[model samples]
Target chain A: MSLQASRNISRFWEWGRKIICVGRNYADHAKELKNAIPKEPVLFLKPPTAYVREGSPILVPLYTTNLHHEVELGVVIGKGGTAIPQSAAMEHVAGYALCLDMTARDIQDECKSKGLPWTMAKAFNTSCPISEFIPKERIPDPGKVNLWLKVNDQLRQSGCTSQMIFSVPYLISYISDFITLEEGDLILTGTPKGVSAVQQHDELQAGIEDIVTMRFTVDRQDH
Target chain B: MSLQASRNISRFWEWGRKIICVGRNYADHAKELKNAIPKEPVLFLKPPTAYVREGSPILVPLYTTNLHHEVELGVVIGKGGTAIPQSAAMEHVAGYALCLDMTARDIQDECKSKGLPWTMAKAFNTSCPISEFIPKERIPDPGKVNLWLKVNDQLRQSGCTSQMIFSVPYLISYISDFITLEEGDLILTGTPKGVSAVQQHDELQAGIEDIVTMRFTVDRQDH
Candidate 1:
């Protein structure tokens, strides 16, 4: 009988990352949103403050009518660099985790119409819910994992990381070319197709097969 | 005799209370950019990740054809709430400081044209540079503060916080209506009239009247 080696537990102090989110890194999701599949990684940010802890409840702002759930794979950086080459990019990665980049779809639409920043829509309280770090060594290849999201009892979105237009190393290298990646920073790889609107009191269960499971509840801000 | 304390000894996180940034907050700036003074805060997110140490250098991205500097007063929140009365808003501030909301104007304009997120343009690496936090006990009145910026001994922007269309308190309360602020979150009050472009190797300086001075130099990426 083999005893599992005692899992080494470590404490991370108020860890926050520069969340670089890739928009439409996956071709099918981009097609569903009617956006062109970009030649380069499409990036955005979910402020460090937008990070919601694994156990914290996801807050749904009252100002928007439709809030959506986007299940993504988050890559956390252990090293820092500027203009990193594609070959040396993976070395900068510290670990991976399951993340949900929540959005206020209605507000995002308003921003689209008025030509405004998506800050209000893409970033708000509890907009990004991330799982605990899984060391990169555990996952041999990040580009072939199975990702899924389910609301309550029904599965909503399911896809493989293999579908991404840009692979993991490519995204890490591409983003570094544009912005520096620092320790504790996170890159939220794009979500799969079947993105849908979520309502208050909805239970969101999102995960990557055999990796991490994030369960969260959406509630209106109790101001 | 009391020895003078170095301002460098002090550290501050973003003040909690949703940060509300006005779009084209200045009338003249609005006119120059062909935008109207927003009746409401041109609300956006500069997540906690966007916050930096007082004297950190602001990095310039390679793709930007023009980089602009916009100097403004940063209001820190001491107290927080939702639906806060404008009459009682000022009581929430913890203190104020000088800040630069650096912009890759050309990239931002391109995003505006494509109806995309401004993250690439506004929320990139080291885009925000702020001064050390001065407690409210020190800054009695936020609106009366003077803000300025210089590029290598040449004054580029000079203005007082008094010119703002939306007062500090109103912005704090108004922003709280949508997003909730937490400790160490900063609200960059809009920049005054003069906002111009900078080039590689240019030295930038920003500060409050006789209170703080932040300086840095821009360099081209060595990719």
Candidate 2:
């Protein structure tokens, strides 16, 4: 297979390893879903094939009926490190992107109940939709930006990063302690409240302040 | 970063995406662990950083008191496909490797009880130890091979591929229906009967019918 450049980052990087995601980072979001606030970050993963860029529609997997859109701020790692200190974590970030963590809620719930892995629910193709990246310099304070998402032109989620239970640097430090963070690896900071089911032909838009914006359409998988 | 050859596979392949795994694919193994026989294949994942070779030591994560070794066969994908049929699945096979799915049983049990993702329990660095790849032709009958692991000359896991609940082709087909498979990606067939903990300086030797053999030492994380 030929090497391909990342859709957003201009530095010509490939999807190095995995897309690590944090769950229940925002108090209100966790409360909305009736989940206890986690003492530490809850983590999951999406394979590289889950990546979907603009101009392509997010295909709802045939196995899931309830697919929800979770808007999040994605931290793209520029440098790789292990056991990185929190004070110096920011030095490893290359940029940021607006992302949607499309989830198969029904499948996920079933997996959780049976103590099974969440691969089918979170790691399907087109499960992640991202916007063009904004260099870290552009978003001087990643923890204080406002991010929102709209479904079919109606706002569904609106929140600020300040409400996150864990900060970007803290997550980087926490994750690198166990899983080595490599260049091109992405960290999907957890979503906020107002996550709802999306269906075929629905148009979704999301942005982070004015730094980056993205649009996507949902379609059912025919095969 | 420049592309590097896979640690075990000699065909100059890069770590494509995820390390997809099968759990409870052997009924005897499931019974040994007191887990019910799964109706379908149980899936999980390990990140690329989890890949470790013979000379390297498997570091015991500081958080777990019970770390067990699961010996299994690893299939390397040479072609990428989605929703592929079983008849065509074998064409995608590149080769096979003897692998160890190191598990933190204590942490995994906690995560399972809480209905949480197993990222912490399963995706840590050095969680997977692999032997050099044996080309597909060398193992023409993947379903009829003997795999064994010995810890300090005491036999732990002894099993044969004939006992697998899910044949490799069926697993590849079933997995592709939900998760896309890519070249250089690995599929860890589930382990069999015996599993026990290892400590610092423990020597591990595993092999597949004299076709390929590898040895590793265990060490505790100093930090």
Question: Residue A152 of model 1: what lDDT?
Answer: 82
lDDT by residue for model 1 (A113-212), tens:
7878787788776898877778888777898899999998689999999998988888888877766676777888999998998888889998888877
Q: Give a tens-digit lDDT track for model 2, residues A1-223.
A: 2243322354312455779999999999999878899999999988888888999999999999999999999999988899999999999999987899999999999988988889889989899898886788999999999999999999999999999999999999999998999888989999999999999999999998878889999999877
What is candidate 2's lDDT per residue for B1-223, written digit by digit as tens?
2243323345322455778999999999999888999989999888888888878899999999999999999999888899889899999998988999999999999998988999988899999999887799999988999999999999998999999999999999998987889888899999999999999999999999979989999999766
| C-alpha positional error of residue B104 in candidate 1 after TM-score superposition, expressed in Å | 1.2
Angstrom error of the Cα, residue A155, model 2: value is 0.5
- In candidate 1, the residue pairs with backbone N, CA or C atoms under 3 Å apart (3 or more residues apart, or in different chains) clash, namely B13-B184, B14-B184, B14-B185, B15-B184, B15-B185, B16-B182, B17-B181, B78-B94
Off by over 4 Å in 2: A1-13, B1-14
Poorest stretch of ten by lDDT in candidate 2 chain B? B4-13
Q: Each model's DockQ? A: 0.34, 0.57
Candidate with the greatest DockQ versus the true structure: 2
All candidates: TM-score: 0.86, 0.95
Per model, kept true contacts as a fraction are 0.43, 0.71
